[model samples]
Target: MSGHGFHVHGPHDHAVEHAAHGSDKFSGNIAVMTAILATVGAMFGYQGGATQNDAALFKNNAAIDKTEAANRWNYYQAKSNKQNLAELAMTLPGADAERYKADVARYKTEKDGIKKDAEKWEASSAEWNQKSDAAMHQHHQWALATTAEQIAISLAAITLLTHKKWLQYTAYGVAAAGIGLGAFAWLHVDPIGALALKLGMGAAGH
Candidate 1:
């Protein structure tokens, strides 16, 4: 099929008619396999896009929270400076010491509230950062799975062209790998990270 001034044809497309009329079933098998791979690849691609969007959104939220935290901290610093000035006034010869003490106490209370608010925003930012990291990791997994499916589809095309039984089997293997990766992504498991953890533990044991 061609669309948007681009023509797309697989190697199998050229041999499809020839293989259909052949006495063997290779053509039919490759056709079915490619069709299945295409369907699965579409699903993986959609999931990848969704997770990527989630990652971006979550990261944006994290940035917003971080900015809020910074603003609160800046406010807290301003309050501290005012408190210091009040305390300095308490030591001055002509200043009302009692009024300066009250001001100092009020500023302490305000600073406490600001500090708590800043800490809450920092925690929220950290939580959002974690979620973004998770979504990005899942997006990578989906992308890798989609890549696997594309490779399988390519192998299917080549198998149809060369009629190589080995190529067909290889395509099936790659398709299975794609499915496995997709499953891991769906389950929110990072296989590569798990493997690394295991290896690190083993090394530590040694």
Candidate 2:
């Protein structure tokens, strides 16, 4: 058959080869990106979860303080009632009149101390409630920002996978996400989580 002097392989072969190479590269890139994303996501999720726990713990502590204050106040009231009964008993003409008076005096002293302690605990509980609220607010903000940043990273990663030519844009997006995550970790999670983790480690060691 008469044909062009330059004999070449079919164009389809080259196209297929090119596509195969591109697919391999894309697959490798996807694996690497998935690993990175998973790691970052876990870190972010753990931080968010820990902060939520801290907020819960703070709330629980505040509740405990309030319960303690209430108990102390109840104890004071009961002691005051007992003191009044002792004073009544002291008025009776009996050999134990002096002992009854002494008992009443003791009850009065204990009731006074309990009243002061209850007041202190009341004030302390109020302060703890305020602190717990502030911690909850801070944790909520951190969780929100971290969640947004993770979403942005995931979206950017998907965009990059779809459009390889936009690799540069994805790099910038990744850097921004990293910065945001670092800031969130440092400000919110690190402080509280580190302490809890340390205590956990200590307990585990034992």
Candidate 3:
């Protein structure tokens, strides 16, 4: 009978291999989490930027409407004041009474036309205000939704980094809640709603 010597590798190598495998698994998990976070962040950023641009546009439109309204009002007021002054001058027993009367007639004609135009602009101003307000409100809602989504995504990323399962689940739940809220806001306050308000206001001559 011949006996063969048996040798076994030490446990150190096995322990090292186990640790290496565990590290690889952890790295893979982190990579997946990072990719998800990046994708969500990008989406939120895009929506946020769009909302901001829309808000700016609405503000600019409102400003323009207000300026036009003011100008129209001022023109009417100036015309009225000038007509009054001309009448007062005519009564002053001055050498240029005939000239004053002619000036008064001219002013009256010009003022009548300006009055009609002012009324039209006033109606337009009211319509514009309604439309701009609606648009601004919609943009604000979109901004809020984007902000909520951003917060949820950030929380999820933090949970993933810390390997907190419960926290991660909570983060997902919050994200779902945010999505629902965003949907509700969009439904209630949208650009279509703004456009409809504008059309209705115009038809009503507001």
Candidate 4:
């Protein structure tokens, strides 16, 4: 994971120049290591893409729910205004008290219905918010997986450049870490709760 692959051997290092880059065995081994890294990179890349798609979909849903909730509140406000007008009319003199009373009663009934609808919308918005948070958690998991895989690939590159078998072994360790991250992403297991942090772009109930 570090950029320290250019380590230089001491004075006698050139003694092994006979087995330099032209050796078939060395080339073959480096090629194989590269191939393995490529395979793992591709798999993790696909997983990252799919995770992004899901996050986008959840964000869209959250937006829609929040908009609907706002609309319901607006409707509730309109009903309240009408109710206020009706009550004011009832306070005014003689325009047929019965008609004013009837209007007031009608407005009150409408307000009750509007109140219930507004409350329902609010509840629905909250549910959508919870769903969005869960999706975001998964998105973070995928991000972690992708990061690990990228580091592993870099390590593999160093392995090829330095022709150090130990570097390749270190690459394997990094690759295993990447695989572990992928497994955690797939299983939705974030023991540290770090994945719960919001990306702020796709949050619901905003």
Candidate 5:
């Protein structure tokens, strides 16, 4: 699902329909699980799309700020060149040295202001870039969670077909992993990195 769009997998729906018709505890349970997983997957897909859009918007903002910063820097450079020219004029034998000196000072002041503006825009660009990266990371996490949910649903379908006990267990495990990934995404934590850090800390403690 993306934006206002919604979709259902035909195979999963067919499996769900078959499960719903059966008059057994196993079929009923599988049906319910599939339904729940479908809902969760839809939600995760939507969140993934939203985060991706946010990342793009933030990246665009970063580019705009970067462009503005470049423009300001260019303007600052122009002022510097003018200031240098004025200083050169001040060195001429019959030039109005005082007027040229005043011009140089004015250009210096203008350059300072432009430089400040450029720096401010550069900082803003960096902040936006960071936001873009964060949103992109969240999007990837949601995508992973959604993929896990999809795989779980597929496994559940296969279990329905084969009536295999292990397939059901595998589906449950996959669904749990999906939920864990979603939680990590919600908390803005990198699961792999966090796990690595924890292991490293435990090792160092010894």
Candidate 6:
């Protein structure tokens, strides 16, 4: 889902070596493998789409919370200015001195409540940030999984073309990795995301 907003781009292009179908060394076997790959590939693709959608939803929610927090802080600042003004007005010598002092006390109490509300909104924003990060991490996992699936499908085609046992085994290995990555995404295990974060931080230092 990554480069821009909520919509996800398609998976990367895979270089598959297709074999000619008419009895060209186990074409029937190739057909079966292709069918199986098609099914699994569809499932992985759907999961990737779902992951991207979830990530977008979280990002949107985080934006909402951030905006609300900003508004709350603005309100807090207005209240603070009012409290300061009331305090300053209390210094004037008049029959209204007591009234100005009362206003000062009221403003101070109202400012305290505003401060709490601002802090609560800030905390809410932080929570939303965490959620958005988590969703993005899951999206990365799904992207990796989908890439692996594509590679596996390519390898399966190449295996049929060359009839190499090792190549078939490698295809299976890639497919297993795809399944594992998909599980990581769904389970919210964040090894790949953590590694990316670490690498990004390291690069920024340079």
How do the predictions measure up, each by TM-score?
0.92, 0.56, 0.56, 0.71, 0.90, 0.77
lDDT minimum window of 10 residues, candidate 1 = 10-19
TM-score-better candidate, 1 vs 4 = 1
Q: How do all the candidates rank in terms of TM-score, highest first?
A: 1, 5, 6, 4, 3, 2
Pairs clashing in candidate 3?
Answer: none
The alpha-carbon deviation from the true structure for residue 190 of candidate 5, after best TM-score superposition, in angstroms, is 0.7
**What does candidate 3's lDDT look like per residue over 1-206, in tens digits?**
23766656322223233334666564355345434544554565566566556656756766776677678778878988998998899888545888888988988898888778777766776776666666556556656665665666556555545767776677667666656655755576465567899999999995
- Candidate lDDT scores, in order, read 0.91, 0.65, 0.63, 0.69, 0.93, 0.72
Residues 120-197 of candidate 4: C-alpha lDDT, one tens digit per residue: 777777776677677777777777776776676666565555878887788778778877877887888885664355
Where does model 5 exceed 4 Å of error? 1-9, 196-206
lDDT for residue 172 in candidate 5, whole number 0-100: 99
Models sorted by lDDT, best on top: 5, 1, 6, 4, 2, 3
Global Cα lDDT for candidate 1: 0.91
Residue clash pairs of candidate 1 = none
Runs of candidate 4 with Cα error greater than 4 angstroms are 1-30, 194-206
Best by TM-score: 1
**Candidate 1 lDDT tens digits, 8-87:** 66544544554667667778878877877888999999999999999999999999999999999999999999999999
Candidate 6 residue-pair clash tally: 0
Residue-pair clash count for candidate 3: 0
